[model samples]
Target: MTDWITTPVEPRLLRGALDVERTAHGILPHRLPAWARKQFPDPYLAMVEAQPSGVRLALRTRATAIELDVLPTKTVYQGAPVPPDGVYDLVVDGKLTGRASVPGGNTHTIDMATWSAVTRPGPMGTARFAALPAGEKDVEIWLPQTEITELIALRTDAPVATAPRHGRRVWLHHGSSISHGSTAESPTATWPALAAARGGVELINLGFGGNALLDPFTARAMRDTPADLISLKVGINLANADLMRLRGFSPAVHGFLDTLREGHPTTPLLVVSPVLCPIQEDTPGPVAPDFDAPKLRFRALSDPSDRTSGRLTLTLIRDELSRIITQRSADDPNLHYLDGRSLYGEPDFAELPLPDQLHPDPAGHRRIGERFADWAFGDDGPFAVSGG
Candidate 1:
């Protein structure tokens, strides 16, 4: 076998990464450690949506390779008995590079650490580091089976740039499961990824699975981060978790935006309501089925008489948010609003239903991506396209 000579690294690699990707997996270990197994009693708990919920990093590199010092914003830990095992695919310059695996899917393997998880060998780890092929490059991170997470190359210095970079202006988005790319096939196919691609701009997604509840800390995070454009995909998580009432939601959204305004006073900020989800569209909240003790299953009881009690439909929330944005826009010209259905709606749901009835499938992600791109960056849009 002939030996392959390694390519030299370039100076451009030292700048912060031009893109990032999330490709995590769920592992159901055959053997569970006494201390690790059976963390959560429910079986569904074991499938803790292993996708990387959020990512933040300050990339640095020498003349050799790009350094990935990643800060995972959220990693779901269900406390199940057995840890899940799987590998995430990594691609650079439109080619498969290598894989990153969580051997045993240890829930505590990556504990609640604030420091970044630096994949020292860069996107492909150290195994096949030479495949990066030196020069202006286009990197894409693909999910194993679904399109739940993806990061596109905004800027690079590889041999060939398949996806060219626009301007430095970045559009940052924050949301719940939808934003987290639930059930989407491949990472690049997600709505946010699609939108960024269509607009040809960089993106910083802060979507957290089951975690977008108008949290003050998240607002602070947005305020503290740097961005040329900003948006918050709200309502779904609050409705799903049944965390707060309608009365509390309206004011909470205002507060969240207010906090971000402190940091992004002039930046265009768009607020997105929840996408269309039929199961709970009109239903006030989730009602668990009755569980018979003999079957070892728990059930939920919901009173049909109470419609508004549990239901926080997308239509209702979207309308309310629109009203709020209209009211606030008079004072804040930078504020904007977009209906969630514009991303995904009843028509799309009829074709691609979410497995859990709350999340979007891969096809649904494509639909969302297409619609969002058309609405935000299409010729008729209020927003302008960015090109470098």
Candidate 2:
């Protein structure tokens, strides 16, 4: 091991987190505040929120190399082969400069066949980035979006300090796994990150895989956070989770917006619907896992005939969402709605089909990100920068 100076991870260096929890092993960053976390203590919620979707450590240093000791909680599907290792993206001076991953951490194995799970302990590991240019420059080590990471230690050959703030507008975004960088090539390549780069804004991602269920705590979390602009990508998770019916969804959505508006009455709030998921477009869900194939796939389990009974589907949710936003927008001009299909519609799907019949691939992510930037941050868009 190389001799190096170690520094404690401080709050000033962290971006995109609402709070940090000090654990016996290391510091765990949380996108949801402690109060909100306390309210919903399910293991699933804890896992996804602690994954640090868009969180990163930003600082300035002249060190030629840096290392971060992390304890990651990796998830494994019991019968299938292990998933790819989670990735950490290193950004230098606002550009993606490197990528790395630790060797081992904790593991949570789930048997889709039985819907049972178990947690096993794993050893801590280190991620090191070397060959950085020797000069005082800004560096951001973006944590893994798919793993629950506890930052153990940060080491460098030279002294490190908090980097100067860029004074960019903070854009708070909430969505599902797609927004959580699910199939993106890397952390910074997630659609939201890509849009932030193109829009010249700072990002605080509240995207939690399999957990953006319009929870009251989430809306309250969004209400309390500081943001110049805000967005909600609703539908897919709700449908897939089969969380509620159409009647319940409308009021739940209205109540969610009401809570957010209480804190940000005039803030530009954009409500986005679901992108095309051919499986759930018309079929109602509680999506079921198709484990027969080598690669795990999802199938909408609810019947089309069930729609009359108020079962949720992408088409039904999108229509209700558009109506809700339209009605609300008449009285609150700051509120706006964007049909998600506009971002990834039929034509795009034909070119870049969702690999698992759900989440988009890397190319699809790039396409969605670019399209979003053009529409949401364009000259006539609601989030357009002044004088742009």
Candidate 3:
């Protein structure tokens, strides 16, 4: 009997369904990236709350050798139309096989003629890709584009290997869009992904876009899930969403951590604050929506005067978080605190300005990923926080 081994992915075409929602910028209709549009045109749209909007992709094989590519959509500051030609390459069996050209990268401008498949709308999007030949084949997929949001890889068959058993258990993380991979070129390139890989740890990414609100339900969810190491990246969204005041934030943060500690009294927990955002570094008052068009969406927050004057800053967030951690540390030694600037900072911002006054670009993602890998796994790092 031949010992058939499962591969990470099979040799056939692939299918995907993306649940996403358009927020902050509501001008353009929601659509797949340029590369995806080429294969599947005419997707459906709908209204949903709390859940991400859905989109799908189908990969098929037209030739004996299969190849494909993608260029993910990126954040265009204040909806300033993304650039053209955000193309990506597709690979099969560790070899470059095909290519995709995402014209404009966003707004459904993909043209995939060399391959075959139909794009339709159902739940998410109904799309189909060809399957692989019979027998065992090893497959590894990579995304060449650097954009934000989620990319889930589903295979037609089970992987040949089981989850490797390292000395320690897996670490499941929950955080903001940053943890979801804001401007990462590929899934594996995200900072969290890179950190997990470097640590040789299994990871379940529960990162939702604009969804880290320190909610009781989310905290309970984390409390209920099984994990070894747990971390939460907070602050920026609360500030951006204009959700609450400092007084309200402190208790909410404590409640969030308290709930997690209930389930994991001894689990090493890391609390991370927001990275540096120049515009909000030293300014006060909120960004007023243009009353003329509530949905116009603009950068009312970035002001040369405010930056020069020194007003709103991440230091405020860091200080608040530190105060909380200092108090909690007296009772919880397993608790750890991390400043986001340790991963990316003002100096780095000079090189990569995040396009929008917020969110890291691809290069920024790379920098953060590398820095995190070094800090969290270094000789004296806190990779493992033991408890009595």
Candidate 2 to native Cα RMSD, angstroms: 1.6
Alpha-carbon shift of residue 264 in model 3 (angstroms): 0.9
1-388 per-residue lDDT for model 2 (tens digits): 6679999987878999999899998788999999998898567777788888889999899988899999999988787778788889999999989999887789998787776779999999999999998799999999988888989899998889998777889999999999998788888989999999899888999998887888999999999999999999989988898888888999999999999998999999999999999999988888978877668788888777778768898988988998898998999988999999999999999999998899999999999999999999999999987621
lDDT tens per residue, model 1, 1-388: 3233333222132112222222342111111122222343423222222344222111221212332212122233222123223234444533446554322111232221231222122132121233454444455433322111222221222232134433456787888767766445444555787677677656666665556678676677678777878888898756555667777888998899899999989787888888877755655554222233332221223333455643565556777899999999999887888988877777877778665567776677777877776777667553454310
Candidate 3 — worst ten consecutive residues by lDDT sum? 45-54
TM-score for each predicted model, relative to the true structure: 0.65, 0.97, 0.62
- Candidate 2 clashing pairs? none
| Residue 218 lDDT (model 1) | 64
Off by over 4 Å in 2: 1-3
Candidate 1 positional error at 136, Å: 4.8
Please report the candidate that would top lDDT against the real structure: 2
How many clashes does each candidate structure show, in the order listed? Answer: 31, 0, 32
